[model samples]
Every structure is written in C-alpha cells, then in structure tokens.
Target: MNDTPGWASPGSAPSDGQDATVPRPSEPADSGGASSKWSAAQPPAGQWSPPSGPDGTPAPAPGPAAGWGGPSHTGGPGHNGPHHGWGAPPAAKPGVIPLRPLGIGEILDGAVSTLRAHWRAVLSVTLVVAVVSQIGDILVQRYLLPAPVEVDPNASPSEALDQAADSAKASLVALAPSLAITLIGTLFTTAILTVVISRSVLGRPVTLSDAWREARPRLPQLLGLTLLLPLISVAITMVGIGPGLLIGSAGGVALTFLGGTAAVVVAIWLMIRFSLASPALMLERQGVIASMRRSAKLVHNAWWRVFGVQAITLLLTFLVSLVIGIPFGIIAMAVDGDGLGGLLSGSSPEFGWPYLIISGIGAVIASAITYPISAGVTALLYVDQRIRREALDLELARAAGVPGYGSDRPGHGPTGG
Candidate 1:
C-alpha cells in the first residue's frame, strides 16, 4: 500500500470500504478470461516517477506500479503494489469534513456541521456579539440618529428634491453608527468563532473561553484587516467617481453613473478576492497585509467558486433574517401602536422602546444563527483550498491523528495560533 502523503488522487470520491475494481489498461488478456493477468513487458523506472521537488530532488516513487506497467503483476495474495480490485481508503473524516478538496455542498455542510457540533461555544460568541450590537444600534437609533425626513406631497419639485436629499443624508447618518456597531461585533465574533472552527476541524471540542483566549491576541490585526478592506474599496470608489463629481456637468452625470458602476464591479471583485483573508489571518497568524496576499494567492484561480459560495451564503443568511425578522417586525409594530399606523399610511414608521426591543430580539436571533455559518464557511473554504493546492490534508490527517498518516509522530497541529 502506498502510504505517502500525496499518493491519493485529487477529487477522488470517498469510498465505503468496498473493493473498487479498476479496469485493466488496453493490454491483451490470457485465454483464462481474467483481465488481472498482465503481459510480461516492463517499462523504464524513471518514465512513471512522481514529479521532482522544488530542490531538484525526485519524490520517492510509490513502490512498483504493478497494475500498470512495472512487473510484479502475479496477482497472488502477497502482491502489495497498486493493483485493481482493492478499494482505495476513504479520505480521513476526523472532523466536520473529509480531509480532501471540498465540493460546494461539502463546504456548506461542514459549516452547518460545525455549528451543530459546537453549538454552545459558537452560539455563545455570536449571541453576545449580536445582543451588544443590537443594543448599541437601538440606542443610536433612538437618541443619536435624526428622525426620518418626511417628504410633503404638496411641495414643489425643488422642495421635493431637497427633501429627497435630506432623506438620503439622514439615512446615511442613521446607518453609520449601526454599521460601526455591527462591524465591531463582527470583528470579535469572527476572531473567536475562527478559533472555534479551527479546533472543530481537528475534531477537538473547544470552550468559549479557550477560543477567546486563543483569538484575543489576533484581534488588533483582524480589526486592521476588516477596516483596511472597506477603506480600500471606498478609495477605489471615490477615485472612480471623483473625476465626474469634479466636472459636475450633464455629461458628468453619465460619467458618474458609468464610473460608479465600474467601481462597484471592481470593489466586488476585490472583496471576493480578499474574502478568505480573515480565516488566513486568524488561522495562520499572518499580518493584515500578509493575509490579504495569502488570500489573493489562494483565490487566484478560484475566484468564481469563492464568489459563488459567498453569494449563496449571503442569500441564505438574508433569507434566514427575513424569515425570522418579519414576525418580530409585525409584532413590534402592533405592540408599539404608532408603527402599524405609519406602515398603513405609507410613511416612515416611528419606533419606540417597545418596537425597538422586540425587533432587536429578532435581529439578535437572526445574527446569532447567521454569524457562525458565515464565519465557518470562510474558515472551511480556506482549509479546502489549502488541501487542494498544497496537500494540506496530509498535515491535517497527521494533526487529527488518523491512523496511517504518521499520526504517532510529533508534528504541528492545525491551529488558529
């Protein structure tokens, strides 16, 4: 049996311990009608060797290639070469996923599986973060944020235009503090949940405190990465639209529209490219810049796959939020008394403490469920990419103490630290 690290073929479906019979190559069979019997021809040794290492050293060939070309095809009980009719071992499943290149379904399932396995720790982190965020948002909306601007239907066109501008400005102002709160909350939850997910990958149970302890030192770097990415996107957008705004003519309107669309496209591309940086940063202990570079490297040929996973996850979370929030919203409006009337009359709803508290509970519940899934997917995607490109499954197998992959020897485990 070839037990070397990289011997397994990429994208091999995990087997179920049954002997998988491989068809013989197009060689003539004996009169007995058995395809297992091989011809007596032999091939040169170096012709079918594994690729050379970076240092120009040849990787060790995995024994005699019996079923293919290099001799040893006696088909006896003692034959130990790469023969047909023997089932390849399944990929090691020491944790939430098999230690192999993951498909989209596996990745999604792995994330949900982590949440299911470590619900206490994962939910604790997300719940606290969500509650704090919602509280801050509620307070900011109630006290600091200006009321929604009401547009008068009886007003002139200029007045309506002015009202629309004011409404936009007010909306921005109202959203700023909420966004800030959410960002900070997301930062903390990402750091802690990342630690939990990393441990979960190794099939290790983790406590909330243990995860927090491991993740605390990386918080500042994580914050930097989180803030830096948005800043970069904003800078790109400003640059794209700045020229048109400076010109400020009728043609500039068209230019601004085009430039803004282009900028948004670029921003989305860059964001998807850097999406894996958080898990890279948290798991690899990389700097913000180094993590971004690592993410770019990992995502180079997999942009659309990564983007598709992220988009699907985003849609799922959105749906979850909508499903959970609608009931709470209606209840809040009913309880608050004024919000229902405002909704019926097609105006901005005035939210009081009763409405805010009820709605905040729904937001908390939605966030608690969604946060872990999002973070888990990102972390698992990082693991999946590394396994595909770098044979990280071998290392993971060893770390997870799978029997055949040299688990008895001392080695570095996959860890967030």
Candidate 2:
C-alpha cells in the first residue's frame, strides 16, 4: 500500500481558523451543561479511523479527494460537518461558470482579455503578415496589368500589328514574376497568421518566430483549406448555365435569393466547425486534418453559439472597416474620380506615388484593427468551451500560478474541487 493520503484516512480536517489543528466541541450546548450524546459519538482525533471488518482489513478507500469547493459534499463547508476557512461553502463550486447563455458583453470581455494577454505575439505576427500581404498586393498591381496594344494612326496595318505583338511580349515578361511573388506571399502570410492568432487567443505563449516555424510544416494543409472554398465556387459555377446567365442578367432575383441564402448557411456552418481548428493546430500541434477533426468534435453541439459570436464579430469588423473605408473612398473619389473609375474598370493608370501611398496606408490601418478583434474573439470562444466542457478554468488558474481558493480574480472562476 502506498500509504499516501487516501480519501478514507482520517487526516486533519479542513481549517476553520488559520490555526485549525486545535479541536473544538463536536456539538454546541449551554456553557456549563453536560456534553450531548452526539459529542461523545465523534472519536477523539488520535483514535479516529474507519471501522474495520471482521478480518481486521480496513474498508476500501473512498473516491479521490473532492476539490476544496466542488458541488458535492466531501465533508466540506455547507455539508453536515464543521465549516472550514479554506474550503468554500457548498454553494461555491469554483471554476464553473454558471450555465447561462453567453451575452455579447461577456464575449467582448473575453476577447479584450485575450488581446491584453497576448498582444505582443498577436501584433507581431499580424503586422508582419499584413505588411507582406500589402507588399504582395502592390507588386501584383504595379507590374502585372495586361499590356495595352500600341495603335499608330500613321502606320499601315502590318506595322500596327508588329507593335501590338511587341507590347504583348513585354507585358507577359513583367507580369509573371509579380503574380508568382504575390501568390506565394499571400499564401505564406495566411497560414502563419492563422497559427499565430489561434495560439495567442488560446492563452498560450507563442513567439512570432515560433509561430512561423510551426506554421511552415502545415503550410500545405492550410493552403488546401484556403483553396477549398474557391474550388467549390468554381465547381458550382461549372455545374450550371444558370450561374453564367445569372451574371449576365441584370436582375438575378431568383438565383441571387437562392445563392445568397445557401451561402449564408454554409458560411455559418464552416465558421462553427473550424472555429477551434487554428487553436487545435497551434496548441495541439496537429496537422490540418486532425485539427479540423478535433474542432468538429468540440463544436458538435455548440454551433449556434459559435455562429452567433462569429456573426457579431464579422458585423463589428465590417462596421469598423466601413467607418474608415467610407471616408477614404470618398476622398479617393473626390481627388481622382477618373482614376478611380479607370481602376475599377480594370484599366491601369500610369503608376503614380500618391494614389498607392494613400490606399496602402488605409488598408494597413483597417487590417490591424480588425484582425486582432476577429482573432481574439475566436480564441476567447475556444477558451470558453474548454472551461465549460473540461473544467479548464482551474487548469488555467494553475497555469497562471494562482493559488487554489484565494480571492476571486476577474475573468476567471474559482478552482474546482
């Protein structure tokens, strides 16, 4: 027998006072009155032990020690025993958030907490990725536009044809490398950023270098996940002449209504199912398939909650973008209406300094603000599920190096028994 503190052992009871070694009367009565029969029933400290069987073997041990303040009575406060200072009242089960519906405020608070704790990792990864993505955007735009055919009004038809051929050759040479760099940079940034955000939001410590390292191995998987949507879109387009006709038709009332509804439903489901995938990948170090499986399991019955939170986050991000984008768009329109129109119509203006600078700066600001919120909310939701399902609050407290049963802390419940 290990003789460790088995649950059945008559060990020192929980402390009622700071110094709880001192024994007190088992029952209360008048000061001078004879002790009650109940007082006599409790064995003295030194003699207390479980009743032995006829063969003198001790009774089997009770279950593992209950936590200091769990819902069940393990001879702790609010039970039929002397109250203790260390153990919470039976009513106070630590680490269990009440099973009330989560509100927007609670979700927001969790997000803020996540950002405050992991801002360094989050900001570093986000800024790096955003800059890379923006650079890629610039490169693709500047050098990748299809060459315009040169038309010489004074030249004969053959000479004009020769000029157009030369222009086409020049355009292909300029555009190919720029397009490749842009695609590669965007892919790398998305994978690494997803891992970084996932880990940071889950209350784990992750460095930017470490995130990049972890993400590298799973880059292919992330790329596959990224491309899955576009491939599906392409498939849908190929499925019917309806899609092509919808595009040409001015009012796609029936098609638009059906497609929009279907898109929203699928989007909601994907958001919920994959909400935990990034954290699973980063923290559990699983590949994309495994992480996705784990995420699907965790989110099985929690789809609505996930959908609500993600939808709200999207709304928030959209509003923030609109606030910044609307003004910048108006300014851009006012400054160079013709250039804006030309840009929209897929015509490149002569490459200029001012337009790029303003657009680039606005893009960066919008990305920075919106990226953290979206990432933070996902992380918070992951934490909230762990707390709800696996008693993760206590584990987190232990990780944070807080003592059990100390004063309550904000953003956390007490330790479970």
Candidate 3:
C-alpha cells in the first residue's frame, strides 16, 4: 500500500478517476463534442427537418428580394453591377474606339442611325425648309431680277455700256432687301430645324412649336453669325480688294495677289469652322458669339473629321440632286426641243400644270430624303460633342430607359436586357 503513488489512495479513485469511477452525466465525452453528438443523433442530410430558428419556425433561404436583386445591389439581366466604371457604357466592348477621338465614320454612322430612327421628324423639318427655300428661290427668280431694257440697235457703244452698268447697279440695289429677307428667313429656319433634329437624336422631347420657341431666342445670335461672313467679305473687299485693285492698276500686282490669297484663306477657314455653328447655337442655347466660340472649341481637335464628314455629306447630296435633277432636266429639254433657245423662241414652251406639278413632286421627294440626312448629321455632330464633353451616351441610354448602373431598379443590365 505504501508503494502506491502519493497522488492515489485506496479510498480515492485511480489517476483516471471520473468522480469516484462513474462518468458524470453533466460532463461531455472527450471524443464526442455536443454539436458532433447532436449531429450524429439527428437525421441524415436529406431526411433532416428544414433549418429552424430558436423558436422552431423555419428560416427563409437567401434569394433575390424581388424579381431583381436586393434593393441595395444591382443584380439583374442588363444591370451593370457595382464593378462597372463610371461614364463607361456597359455594353461597350473594351479596347474598341474610344468615344473621345470619334472618327468621321462614327459620326456619319450616328447621323444615319438618327435619321433612320427619326425619319418623321427629319422629313417634317426638311419639308418646311424646302418649301421656304423654293418659295424664296421662286421670288428671287421671278421678281428680284430687273426686266431687260429695250435698247435701240442704233444706240452708241458708250451709251449702251453706260446703260448696262446703270441697270446692273439698279438691279443689285433693288434686290438687296429681298436678299436680306431671304437670308434671315433661311437662317432662322435652319437653326430651328437643327435644334429639333438634335433634340430628337438625343431622345429629348421636342415639338415644332417648342423648336421654334427654342430657336427664336438664338435667332439674333444665329443672324449675327450668319452675317459675319458677308460682313467680313464686305470689309475685306472694301479695304483690301478695292484698294488692292486700285493700287494694282497702278503696278502693285504683289499687293493684290497677297491680299486676295489672304482674304480667301481666312474666309475659307472661318466658313469651315462655323459650318456647325447652327447646331451649336440651337442645341447649346448659346449666344451667337458664344456659339461660334463653342463651335471653334469642338472643332479644334477634330477639324479634319468635321471637314471630311461635311464634304462627304455635300458630295452625297450633290450626287442625289444630280440623279433627280438630271431626269427633270432631260424631260425639260425634250419638252423644249432644242432647249433654252428653242423654248425662248416663238415656239414658246408651255408652262403646263403637269410640268409644274411634276417638278414640285420631285422637289418634295428629294427634300424628304436629303433634308433628314443634313439635319441628322448636324444633330450627330452635336451629340458627338456632348459625348466628348459630358459622357452623353450614358445619359442617352438612361433616357432611353436602359436599366442598371444606379437606376431605380437593382440588378438590371445597362441596356435593360
């Protein structure tokens, strides 16, 4: 008994004693924890009861709260998720052409798409412009030109020259007011149409009256911008050309050539830069000076792009006009036999109602197709600028009711897919 370990005794349990040798019910087994024991005692995974709360009611499984994801998170088809970059189009592929450095083809494609989408608006605006242009053309053709004076065949050469010069001066003076009116009307109309087309392309609401209202305020600025070219021409002519011609007549050919070339270059540059001024003036609601400035800014980095697009548009328009005009011209020539001479001779070409009607119809059709193209291009130019400056593509998509990316719904794709 004495040889036994001091920590053990006869009356006490062995070193591995569990409260006098019997395991205590309250103590957990070393090999089996409570959770493990419970799990083992419970049914297998398939046969187990659904998870329950402490109160014994089943707990809800995790899922999207509504048809889409939870309100806090974007989680649906077409919903650009949290990871999307700001001002970036979700649908836009990476490494494609950047929007900032837009190419001529992109601009033209945008313009064409706009026209295709909003043909009605484009047609309506074009019709109005065409009607006004045609009426103005007719007035100028019929009423602005002076009647040729009846000159005696026996009149002296000097007298004939004097009479012709005087007649020419008088005709120009008489046509001035009509010309001014026509220019003003055309500029105002074009400005309004440009605004309408721009708004339409942007998916903004616009009515004819609204377009007119929007354009009215900018008319003064537009008129100022429009007058700039003629004013500059007049100034250069008065100060440079007039003086140059006078001096050149006295043996200063260098001055004349230099002055003329400078004037031509300046005029061309100004015209090219301001070609998009009407659209800027309309869409931006800018003052004439400001609109001009804005146009200069927008065109600065992309002058060639603007120039190319405009040139292409002009060429296309010219080709279309030729296609239409050639047939009409041929018909007119056929009807007039030998053409202008025969028609003006005693043969007296009949101004038949049918001819007038056909010409009018042709004009309308041509206008319908071409007007939209021009308007749409201008609108697209405006859009391109906004896209460069303001990330307008995102705005446009939002306006088009595209989903996701901080829109009202969560978990929706950017394109509302």
Candidate 4:
C-alpha cells in the first residue's frame, strides 16, 4: 500500500522461493496510499530495481525485504509474503522494524518484545517514575487535600451547589502537586524509553544508565514541546469560545456550544498532527519546533492512519491497566469503606492511605508495563514515516552493519544503497 512509483508491486510477488528477490515489472501505483518520505527524497535513478548480474543480467533482490513497503507479499528467504493478506511481510520482527516500515501487528508485537527482552532496564526506569508519581498522588490525597466539605442539608439548593463547587476547587488545588510531578515524569520516561527502543531495534543492549545519559541533553526541549502541545490546544479552545462567553445571552450559549464543538475537532487534528514530535525529537536530536514541524510533515495526508494506530495502542494499554488495576480498586473499596468516617458523611470518595497504597500498587504495575508500549509505538511510527519518505531502511541497515548494504553496486542488494 506504500506509494513509491518505479518500485515493483510487492503485491505480485512470486510464490516460488528463489525469484522472489526479483522485482517484477512495475504495476499501477497505489495512489490512495500515503506518499513516502523515501520516494520524495529520491533521485530518479535511486528507486530500487532488480540488481544487474556480473554479466548484466538481473540478480535477485537481496538482504531481506528491502523496501519500506515492509516485507514481501510472496514467498522469499526469511519471509512468508504470499500467505499474508495485507501485503505485510512477517519477517524481521520480535523487536524488528528498523529495516523497514511496519505492519500494525508487527508494531504491537515489537513493543511487547522490547519490554519482554529488556525487562530489567525498562522496569527500572518506569518503576521509579510510577512510584514517584503515585506517592505524590497519595500524599496530595491525604495530608494536603481537605476531605470534601459536606453540603448543608437545611440550606437552599443554591447554597449547597456553592459548597460543592468550593470542595471541588479545593480538591483540584491539592491535586496540583501530583499532576505536576506526573507530567515531568512522563516527559523523562518518554525520552529515556525512546532511546531504549531505538537501540533495541539494532539489537543493542541499553542499561538504565545508558538510556539516561543519552536522553539527558534533550530533556529541556522535550519538556517544552510536551507542555506546548496542551497549551496550544487550550489556547485554541479558549479563542474559539471567547466571544461567546462575553455575550452572556441565549445567542451566546448557542455560539459557545458551536464554538466548543469546532474547537474539539481542531484540537484532535492538531494532536494527530504533532503526535510524532516526541520520536523526531528524541531519535533525530531535533529541537522542539523542528521536531514538531517534522512530525507535521510526516503526518501529512496520513492523519487517519496515524490516529488508528495510536487509538489501538491506547486501547490495548488501557485494557491492560484495567486488568491489573481493577482487583486492587475492588480491594481498596472493600477495606477502606468500613474504616473511614467520610464514608458515612459522603464528603469524599477517596479512601484512606491503606486504599491509596494498595491501589497505587496496581497503578505502578500498569504504568511500568504500558509506558514502554506507548513509547515504542510512537518511536516506531516515526521510523515508519521515515522509511516511507526517506528510504530510512537502507540507512538503518547501514547503521546496523547489515551485510551487502554498505555497497551501492548492482549486485549488492535490493535497497540499491
């Protein structure tokens, strides 16, 4: 489904083993597909073609699936191209994606495998972040936050509503500490894990120390970019409904609703547009604005594809979090319900410290596992976009020191690198 012209149709790949390396004559291009960064950057002579033999005959396409089209659609060495229905090759996985664009399943599986293979290092980073965040949250919930103030039963309805609003405001102010810490933690963890996942693609070991050292320099920019995104979204939302709020009438209310709906749609568009900025920043060593611009460029005309993949990854992580967190939530409710006086008063639903700690355990476990998956998917999406647009697989192979990729001669391989 990749749209590089002059590239052979991976769809028409042969079922036979040997000649699967040969690029069949070009078929009609898949115009509906997103144009790749690779194809856009390429010179006319640079698109991959069958290698000429020593005697000037065409040689086999070489060195695994060569195009960012991602594996082959027919049988070939180290590939099951024909059996795959989606034109996705099943080869070069289990933390394998750097050498090509990715299948959706491969991206998910690669994330899982990276976590599985480097559990110690990955867990160390995430455990520290998660624990710190959870502890801050518990402290805020307990000592700093007031128990919800009870509404006066005998008062007017308006008085009760005002009391409830005051209680909500106090709780939010108390929550500021935890939320602030969590935001910082997420930025650092994303930076470190992006390093770990990139190295993992090359089959390299990354210690927590190694990840930290590499990730440290870029932290400021990453933090800025991360914070900037939400600010931008909020600013747009406010600007959208600002005029309506000033009017204070029926027309204003209608205008506010319409403006808010439009704002939501714009916010979603911007979120998808900039989703790859983290990876571009971390892996490419790009500055905040540059990375965001890079992300926007890669995501051009591919918003839905990026959104779908991100949505699925998020759903998977959420389900996993629920699986671990639900039991702990139940236990916390059961144990803390009887002991807390607030239960009878109904001022707050937050359980005592016992509940906070217990439930926090589930939160810790879930965050530790899912953080890598989210980070990996984002990083891989950046890689996939590059493979599509910049022929990044060839460069990746060269970086990984893959055999034959170093030579650009006709006999060297399918990448023609």
Best-performing candidate as measured by TM-score: 1
Q: Write the per-residue lDDT of candidate 3 for residues 1-417, one digit (tens) a residue.
A: 111001011122111122242112245565554445444566556776668988988988765434343112111112222323343333431111222325567556665655665556556666776676655655554555565555566767656655654675677676676667556655755776676555554355556666676667777777887888567665764565455556534344457667778877676677667776777666555667766766776566567767777888888877887788678766655554444455668653544444444455566567656666665676566556545433434434443443442352332222232
Q: Is candidate 2 or candidate 4 better by TM-score?
A: 4
The candidates, ranked best first by TM-score, are 1, 4, 3, 2
Query: Each candidate's TM vs. the true structure?
Result: 0.77, 0.55, 0.59, 0.71
Count of backbone clashes, every candidate in sequence: 0, 2, 9, 11
Ranking by lDDT: 1, 4, 3, 2
- Model 3, position 200, has a per-residue lDDT of 51
Question: Model 1 Cα displacement at 157 (Å)?
Answer: 7.3
How well does candidate 3 match the true structure in TM-score terms?
Answer: 0.59
RMSD, every candidate, angstroms: 12.5, 16.1, 24.5, 12.0
lDDT of 3 at 105: 70
Best lDDT among the predictions, by candidate number: 1
lDDT agreement of model 3 with the native:
0.54
TM-score of 4: 0.71
The local lDDT score (0 to 100) that residue 126 gets in candidate 4 is 94
